[model samples]
Each structure stands twice: as C-alpha cells, then as structure tokens.
Target: MSAKVSPSPPLYTTFLVYCALQVAFVSFLFSYYDIEVGPIIQPVVKWVIEKAEEIPLVKRTFELLRTLVIGDEVNEENTKTLKKSTPKQKEATVEVHPLDADLSYLPVFSSEQLSFFDGSRPSKDVCLALLGRVYNVQKGHKHYAPGGGYHFFAGRDATRAFVTGDFTEAGLIDDVSGLSHQDILGIQEWSNFYEKEYKLVGLLQGTYYDAEGHLTERMREVIGLIEDAKLWKAAQTKEAEVFPPCNSEWHKDSGGRVWCTTKSGGIHREWAGVPRKLFNPGTKTSRCACVKNFGPPLSNYADVDEEGTRGDLDNPNLREYPGCSPTSNSCKLQED
Candidate 1:
C-alpha cells in the first residue's frame, strides 16, 4: 500500500463549477458597477470576499474571479488605509457620539482585559478601545495586525493619542478631556471610521465611565461641554449658510440708486437691507431700497458680520450708513 499510495483527490468538478458560477456573479457586479460602490457598501463586499481565503478552493475561486475582473492589479487600498483630519483642525463630520452606541450583545472588557486582545495573548481576536468603546479590528489585519503600523494602539484605550497623534505610551491613556475641541472633532472621524469598518466589541473601563458603565460626573460635564461646543459650531455654520452678510453696490446713475444683496436661502436674488434716499422722480420721497446680487457680501467673513454695525475698527459697520449717497461714493448698506 505504501508503494502504490494515491494522492488526495482534487476538488470535485461540480463544486468547481459552483465556485465558478459564484465568482462569475461577483465579477459581473465588479464589471457593471465599475468598482465605485460608495464608501459604506464596498467595504462590506470586500470583507465578505476576504473570508473565502480560509477555504483554499474558495480562495482559488476568488483569485480566478479577481484575475478575470481586475487583471492582476496590486493595489494598497485593497487592504488597509488611514485618513487623518489634522489634530489642530476640525473635520466637518457629524455622527452619533460614541456613548450613544448600541452594544446589547457584547462582552464587557476591563482595562486589564484589554491586554488580551493585542494578539500577544493566546486570544485569536484583535481589538482596540477608543472613547469608552471597544471595536473588533481583526479583519483589518494589515494595520491592526501584530507588529503592524497601528499595533501600538492595540490592547489600549489610546483615545488621547487618537486625537493628539502621539502613539507613544504616554498618550495611550484614557484621559482625553485635555484635548482641544478641534482635536476631539478630528478623533470623531476615527470613531466613525471604526464604527463603519469594524464590529463593536464592548465598552472600556476607566475614569470617564464607572465600572458599572455609567457616566461619571466628570464625564457628564465634559460631554455636556462637548455637546455645547458642537451645537455652537453647528449654529455658526448654519448662520453663515442661511444668513450671509449684506453687500450694497453703490450706483451713481438714476439719482442715487443702489443694489444690495445678501446670501439668503442660497439664492442670489433681490434683498432690502437698508433705506436708500432715491430721487423718486414721481414721489420724491426716501424709501427702503432693494438690490440685486451685485457681488459677494460687503462683510465677507462671519466674524465681521457678528461685530455688525458696531464701532469696532477691526470689523467696522459695513451695513448701509444713514448718510450714504451716490455723490459720497460710500453708499453701503448698514443695519439701521
């Protein structure tokens, strides 16, 4: 028997045919969609396909499919990626806060237990703690992989470093309240990235969150401040977006006629922001004037508008002044 031992059988033809059909379907989707499935969905398809690697036949099927579809292109984006919105600058991102997570069926991990997830321990899972939440990043092996670029973050609630970009041991602590508003906002993008790219494992134990997972008083206060800052920033953005500064173009013709425009509701239309003393050949009475959008507002910046009509030399009154006329060549709208 040893002399005439036969090799293991090959994959059955029927199974290979089934695998071919499955791969063909994926290939068709790649060809039809042109590989531009937006951010949230394509990662899921890629992750699903990656699981096939555990089975050699299925892996072969995917390789065959990828070869037929992509033509052997080696792309780095196929695996790990990182996008950083600078620490000192705020990223214009808004998503549900990390505390609002829905972790109904995940195991709670203590600070000590987090060490088990670094791939150094026998545990087969890779995870990280961020902003009191744990995310299983086992799938993103290239970055979270053992001795990977982001390996320092593993087995730690390095929330501070996520905001500060300091991946050293000193920054690998739970104290993130000292971070600036912009830094916190920047970290939020990472939070959203993890939320989208990985599965939520559980919550982390620390000062901000009590052992019972309840928000501490300090945490509540800090969160309240963060929320207030977020609201204020949003209000400022909406104010700029909805009500822009008024600009009046001085016109000498038609006996002191002018046009004023302000960006309101996102349309460049007519606006009445001040009283213009027109000759009014028929009535001969001063009246409030409306003007079409001649150009961008006189008060270009929001800060300049906030200082509105006040005597601040840094941001002087740009609204139509009481005595502005065509002869003066200083006819600009100032809020009376």
Candidate 2:
C-alpha cells in the first residue's frame, strides 16, 4: 500500500505548532516593537468597550443583568451611602454679601490647584461655598449653629474663614481683627500648616488669611524680608526648583518640603529662631555656624499668643507630629 499520507501531519500536532508560532511571534513583537504596545492595546480595548456601552441595547442588557442579580442589595447600599454623604453642591449658587468688598475674588486651593470664585458678592458665597468645598457640607441653619460645626481641612483662606467664623462663634476668639505682635507671630506659626503635615517649606510660600487684617502686615513683612534675602534662590541652589504655578521658582525637597531663605545679614534669623549655614550638598547638611547651635530647625504651625509663644487649640501646628516645634533658640548666620 502506498505509504499512508502522514495523516495531514496530525491535526493536533499541527495545531500545537501553529499556537507555538503565534506565541513566538507575539514575544518577538514585544522585544522588537519600539512603540509601547501595552498602553496602546489597553486604551484601544477600553475605548471599544466604552463605545459599546453607549449603544442602547447594550446598556439595557447590562442594566437588566445588573438588576437581576443584586438589585435590592445595591439599592439598599446606595440609600445607606447617600444618607452618610453630605448634601453639598459642587458650586454655591447663593448671592455674596456686599460688605465683603475686600474679601471678594476669593481663591480656593484644592487638588494642589487654585479655583477663584468671581461674582458680585464673593464673601458670603465664597465662605459658604468653601464650607461645602472643604467639608462637603452646604450652608443652612444647622451648619450656621454651634452643633452643626465646620471643617478647615483645606487650610487655605477659604478654610480659614470657615474656621475663624466657627471659632468666633464658639467664643474661642476674642478679636478677629486686632491681633497682637505675639498673636501675629503665633498666627505666622499656625500659617505654616497644610491641613495636617509639617510641610517645612510650602507653608512659607502659601497665602494665609486675615479676617481682622493684623496678620496681613506681618505676612507682608515676612514675605518682603525673605524675598529681599534671596532665601528661595539659595534654597534652589541646594535642591530642584518645583514651585507651583503662579509661584516663583523655589527649591522643594524630594518630599515636597520647601524652605524660606533670607539674606538680610541674617537678622530675621534671630527673631524667627532659624539657623543659617552654608549648604552641604554632599551630605545634605548645613555648615552655617548657626545651624549647629540652633539645631537647624523646621518651622512649626502652632496656635499663638499675643507674645507669639506657641500654644495649642483643637488644631495644633504639625498635626502629624505633636510636640515638635521649631528649634527654640536663635543664632547668627555664617557666610558660605
């Protein structure tokens, strides 16, 4: 008999060889392709699925199946979740009060970005809107009263206004407008906070609020002093410049920490109790004579007294770490 044709090379074996070739081809493509195939393929599949979801029949089928399996459980869970969530609007529609002329053009810093509220009346609306924006709570009689309370997690003016108003109502604040020298410094200390962290550098560059406006003078002075001394410039020389938009190019450590620098023969250094030294890039240390004596302290965010001695409130400076204030001693700066 003629040698039986080799049964078409055995369909099973042929199929296995075909599969192996396919796998090899894919491996080769992965090794040789310059373009990123993973990202390209994933998005393409994702877009196709998204497009398919828009079809009426496909959407209906998905909803029907979804309802069939866990409809009641999902419905109950959704109701419970809704009950726990605050009924805050994304943006406030309330009219701003006219008396807050200077407080208009209020800015909300969120997601590391700024959102400005522009309208005829920005004070009430801005403050009220911030209550919802920061705490996710809308304004109402309950929110206005003591028990309703507020949240200042944003730590920006929007949050500060809410905290100031809340504290004033709580009788914790005697004067919102007439802060003393100590209070001004204490306020400066508190201003260093970013929600709950010891940011080190970001706080000095951030904008703080002043309901009574006393803090404004001190803040301007500090800003001017630091700018005049080219503290930021010096800091930039030590680290990479990572200042935010609308902010000047300034040094930020890898941990998102920033430092404020000043050059005024280092006079402000004594008042603030910060030590200055020649930066040591190799060891990431400071050689300034003052650093050794003053301990090269980071700034604190504490509640302040009229004399500027650090104090505490429901909120403390450097929320993550309590009892860590800026180094208490002062010293003269040394030249590089």
TM-score, cand. 2? 0.18
Clash statistics: count for each candidate: 6, 11
TM-score versus the correct structure, for each prediction:
0.44, 0.18
lDDT of 2: 0.34
lDDT of 2 at 165: 44
lDDT of 2 at 264: 27
Q: For candidate 1, write residues 9-101 as lDDT tens digits.
A: 454544545654565576558665677666876676566555545557777776777675665333333432323333456675534445543
RMSD of each: 22.7, 24.8
Which is the leading candidate under TM-score? 1
